[model samples]
Target: MKFYGIVVFLAFAAFAQGVPHNGRTKRSISDNLETLVESIQALASEVNEDLGIPAFDPFTDDSVAISINQTLAKLEGELTDLNIDGLSDFSIDTLKFTLIGLKFTFAFTWPNITFSTGYSIDGTVASILPIYGDGKASGEITNLAVSGTVAISVKNSYLYLKSMSSAVSLDDLDIQLSGLLNNDDASALIAAVISDTVPQILVDFQDVISDTVNTAVTEYVDDYLGSMTLAELLALIGS
Candidate 1:
């Protein structure tokens, strides 16, 4: 995400400075634009290395609780936590994200982001009656993918990435349970419980997730851009 913002900043700086002031300048503007695109791609790759963003990495969320009420199941509990490795399957190709708005003219338009992966989680229910008492259920949601458009804007010379809209889609959700609720059909009941509850859970925490993402982006961008100066930036472009 930090690299994503820098890609725009670098392109803006290059375009702003590379614009010809006099009729006599021999360099073509297209050449500079072309070079800017290449530099952004190269720099983004290096930043990924510096950030140690592996091709496949795990993402975890530990503090998520949701309340549920449905005809099939009525439950109150937290998602407890989740861990899913091999996130590389969800990784959007750099080109897909970069090429969409790499042109200098499209700097103000936000780019699209997409991700796909499978994740497993534990659910701790304090009260889910009829079917069982206090217990925990484990499950995995496979073929999950999310896509959205992010809006990036500058205010007071500081850049901000805000999630304007997003959508989540998944293929299969399977759950297995234990602790007083264990049965031959435990998985189906657990699945029904989660299916009814998870969507509302996401809806409830949407703003929190958006803020967290924005805050992380702000921190990373501020650190990455803070030490850079106008002259150094120009040097980077020219070099």
Candidate 2:
């Protein structure tokens, strides 16, 4: 029952830290982003839990839509310009990130075989690349350890930083719980928690969880902490 365990997956961990504006430095973007990461991680788990769909219940279709809408709203509000660029360095190509998007919507319209629904921001962040924006005055995130990509574009004063991740895996979680319960009843107990509703759930909630996490990560890299420093940037960040 490794289903309850943390599955390893590739992430867009690219980010920036020290930010310089008009030759002066500000806060560490990486540190602030870490906070966002924490929130996304927790939320992803929650979404996975809510994917309780029973084929017998076609009504689950609408509920699924409502859930996605709710999640999108939460993500959009979370990063209302929280200056993600300030926390990023972009010093290298394929920058890895833990946080940073757009009005990306994805749907899995498979017939009688899949029920995956998702959306993406935009851009790619690698797990190894490090980079910073051009200009000598620009500061960098110190000790900025990352794991994925943080890609963004500037349009109409707004920074659309989106994170993309794939390469994922699902595992068994019954290992840890093995001893918690007696030998006779332990296996069944673990199976019940990790098991899904027959054909209703397949490949687990990995995609849904990944998308939710991606949204949060994208928001983290699109911070507006430094926006207060400039009116033009502020307006952009607010958007």
Candidate 3:
């Protein structure tokens, strides 16, 4: 969600400074903003089709379990070697852990889930930056609320239940460390513990992640489309 917020900010920033440069045709700000709105609506639609129908399950065939371990191993190494400046009581050098093996069980019906509407986006004018590209052009997005109704009945859905091995990637991770513990080396300990534990935890919880993402995407899309600022058009990405 934080990442999404950042993306929204970037999109708006680009809109503000957008010009007919790089061989692109000129478009008014309103046109660009409307495009952004349409993109979101399209997102909702795609989420409904892809996730709602179970047409795309990254972990469906046990592929996730097998692939995630290697990524976890690399993360363990990187965190172990990470160097943080001004570290008096903590060092991110001691981080280490082995990823836990994972398995999944699913009883998915034809339409494993249903989304009644897609997500909604709203922000106060006050949250927008009066000036662009200066400081905090990362303008705040206010009232960015998302609401939807998702129905998931995997338990009642008659289908196959299975588990598999999988692997996940952790790319370009920007790690940050903070906090102090009673004049002690808490930060180092915390980083070490996290580096050791997070991978295993993620591997163990892959199934939950899959189901939650699926439900959230579809429900938000279904609920949001009804009130979308733009009408549904062709697919946003691949058609």
Best by the lDDT measure? 1
- Model 1: per-residue Cα lDDT over 134-207, one tens digit each: 34555566655554554444445543443334445455555555443545366466667775676565556655
Task: List candidate 2 segments past 4 Å from native.
Answer: 1-149, 170-188, 191-204, 224-239
Compared with the true structure, the alpha-carbon lDDT of candidate 3 equals: 0.27
Show model 3 residue runs off by greater than 4 Å. 2-168, 171-176, 180-184, 227-231, 235-239
Per-residue lDDT over 1-239 for candidate 3, one digit per residue giving the tens place of the 0 to 100 score: 22223223333333333223223566433344445433432333123332232212111121111111221231111111111121111112111111122111112112121111111112221234121110100011111112222222122222111222222222112222333232225544544555455545656766654454444344443333333221111122101
**Candidate 2 residue lDDT tens string, 1-239:** 01111211111211111122333544333433343333333333232323331111111122111122332122111111111122111122121222233222221111121112221122212323222111111111222222244344565555555345532232221211222223425534533543333122324554665575666554544453212222343222221
TM-score of decoy 3: 0.28
What TM-score, over all chains together, does every model reach?
0.39, 0.27, 0.28
RMSD of 1: 10.2
Better model by TM-score: candidate 2 vs candidate 3 = 3
Q: Stretches of candidate 1 above 4 Å error?
A: 1-56, 59-82, 91-134, 180-188, 192-239
True-structure lDDT of candidate 1: 0.43
Instruction: Please give the CA lDDT of all the candidate structures.
Output: 0.43, 0.28, 0.27
Distance from true location, Cα of 35 in model 1, Å:
16
